[model samples]
Target: MNWDTIQGNWKQFKGQAQQKWGDLTDDDLDKAEGNREELEGRIQEKYGRSKEEAKKEVDDFMSSL
Candidate 1:
């Protein structure tokens, strides 16, 4: 999914996101607010993952839908 799709469906997808990344708080997701880069950045920061790993995880999660 693209940025737009992510943004549009954020409310629905956030639950899935939380399930995948339990360390991610609702505040983090709110701050991310559908920005793919921001989401990856937050995940990277919170989980201590590399940029590539964060991006891949987000991509995989989005694609799973």
Candidate 2:
């Protein structure tokens, strides 16, 4: 799905994201609230990933969807 669709349906997709990144807590997803950059930040913090890596991972996740 496209970013627009995912953003619009974040309530649904956040669960999928949590599954993919198990270290992320519900609070992190809640804070992201459909914002891709925020989600990337949460992943970067939780996963000890570089900003580029987090962005790439989010991009890959979007592509998979």
lDDT, candidate 2, 1-65, per-residue tens: 78899999999998999999999999999999989999999999998999999999999999988
What C-alpha lDDT do the candidate models reach, one value each?
A: 0.90, 0.93
**Model 2 CA lDDT for position 22:** 92
Candidate 1 overall Cα lDDT vs. reference? 0.90
By TM-score, how accurate is candidate 1?
Answer: 0.90
Worst 10 residues of 1 by lDDT: 1-10
Clashes of 1: 0
| Quality of model 2 by C-alpha lDDT | 0.93
Q: Report the C-alpha lDDT of model 1 over 1-65, residue by residue, as the tens digit.
A: 67688789899889988899999999999998888999999999999999999999988987887
Runs off by more than 4 Å, candidate 2: none
Which runs in model 1 stand beyond 4 Å of their true positions? none
